[model samples]
Target: MTSLRRRLLILVAAVLLLAGLATGVVLHAAARADRANRPQSGGPAVSAGTVTLGRKGRLMFLNAATGPHRTAVASVPATDPRGGRTASGLTCARFYAAAGTGVCLQSNPGVLKQSTRALLLDSDLRTLRTFPLAGTPSRARVSPSGRFAAWTVFVSGESYSSAFFSTRTSILDTRTMRLTPSLETFSVVKDGKPYHASDINFWGVTFASDDDTFYATLNTGNRTYLARGSLSRRTVTTLAQNVECPSLSPDGTRVAFKKRVLSGAALWHEYVLDLSTLHETALAERHSVDDQAVWLDNRTVAYALPANGEVGSSDLWRVPADGTGTPRLLIAGASSPAPL
Candidate 1:
């Protein structure tokens, strides 16, 4: 009986030791998995050979994996080059070209500045050249080929005058820096004139891959949709309505924009519209969102969303283009995100 009791006590000790070892192994494995899925701690890890522009007017061209680096370009001054329209006060805020190169428009600094100039900068943010504008061009986009540029010019008469406000679409030749002499080929006046604020007031403009065709949103209209225009035909058509912040896919096959759908309290949702069928797939439902989207390849999109109700504390979220998966955060503590 004593021997049997001693054996039982030994067996219980061995079982406890084995159980503790198993728990330790499981905890270690879980920690390893968590480390693997964790987001890297740093700014965008751009791969070798990337050109990026910062919000503070700093342009950097560097290779992350490699040691290659280049600072600011020498030609373009850091000052904002202003031109196009006096009322809009347009500045060189962001890049709009479909090509790898960056194109920006800024109002020149001075008294009595009438027009804004389209400043062509290299990938390194070096000033290559500047194109003067006849009127104030609001949203300027370069074609995929980088050969042509299409922009919207919001024209208001002299500041003191009460003349009607008008907006015209213009296409420019990038190589020659000349406005297409055939004005009728690539231009469009808005459907109806607004009250004509002395300043330019519009969202943005974009050009098709062909450079000749383009799209613009006229806030003055009752139903705001992507207006498709033809340069050769001089015609315009409203492609889709109830959408804002239209961003074309990298392939130019479809466009992603935020559509405000009233879901029990005027909630807004974003949807991706297929240009071929004009069909849309709802991406997300949220309270408020900034109109900025970065296409992560053709199948995915990355955007920033407020964490809870605080806009200052935001996180990077990504969703599949097919609208299959749930919205997931890619990286947290990302107040502002720009896709590489």
Candidate 2:
């Protein structure tokens, strides 16, 4: 009987030890993720400065010296280059620039259960603020006036399980210091009527010059639509169908977006939406681009696409904004093109 008791005690002790070890492992992983977090980057002191990161391929800068390849892109006065400078300790999975402001989504350098944080930076690459995000990072954008910033994250319990997968997109008005954690809170309108649904999700918000008005994509009922939203009125209206990740042109008269087409081979085709006529034209880009198309100028659209279906092998490519010329490779091993 004593031997039996000893055996039982040993078994229970072993189980407890194993459980403790598992807990320690999880805690260690969390710590590793936290190590990658940057509440703020290490940089020189600045009361107020511009982001000086020079054009590093993906992050583009426009100035007087920049000989813009396309006609639609505005020509800047030839001046000293302002981009391509490196930001110390500031690494981003995705980055965007507009109106002298920069937004970056920094992801945990881990393979499993990773997290992301959205960071706002000034023109000098100084950290303005940081917002803890809900899931894995996807997209980030700043308003033309640098008044508003927005981002998207994809959360999943399991990488391959759609049932436990979802996305969160949020916006912050830096000028007013207000935050809209979910666009779902805004009033929804469709076809000139109030629209309501249980599964409405919004992402890829692109602000107009007014900065109070914006465009984004809404997905529900197994379909997506382009939506126009107002920051002042706090409302969104459906504008057109089959549009996702809309990037407004520099002129704000056209939007470059990804549209699903009939061909089953390529998942999406790059297209341009004329805001005045509400008409969309398919671009010459034939690859399946699943990104917000950045306007290099009023007439040139650039976006990222995976090379040869390889996941991490994405490269930047541009097509004519008018959908006339063929798509051409712009940058290799680099993406998320943001003008400086």
Backbone clash numbers for all candidates listed: 13, 17
Residues 183-265 of candidate 2 have per-residue lDDT tens digits of 99999998889999988888888999987899998977767799999999999999998888899998889988888775333
Q: Pick the candidate with the highest lDDT.
A: 2
On a 0 to 100 scale, what is the lDDT of residue 193 in model 2? 95
Error of 2 at 51 (Å): 6.6
Q: Number of clashes in model 1?
A: 13
Each prediction's TM-score versus the true structure:
0.52, 0.75
Q: Which residues of candidate 1, in runs, are more than 4 Å off?
A: 1-92, 106-117, 131-140, 150-171, 180-203, 262-268, 285-287, 303-317, 326-340
What is the TM-score of candidate 1?
0.52
Q: lDDT score, residue 252, model 2?
A: 85
Candidate 2 has its poorest 10 consecutive residues by lDDT at: 64-73
Instruction: Please report, in order, the local distance difference test score of every candidate based on alpha carbons.
Output: 0.51, 0.71
The best candidate in terms of TM-score: 2
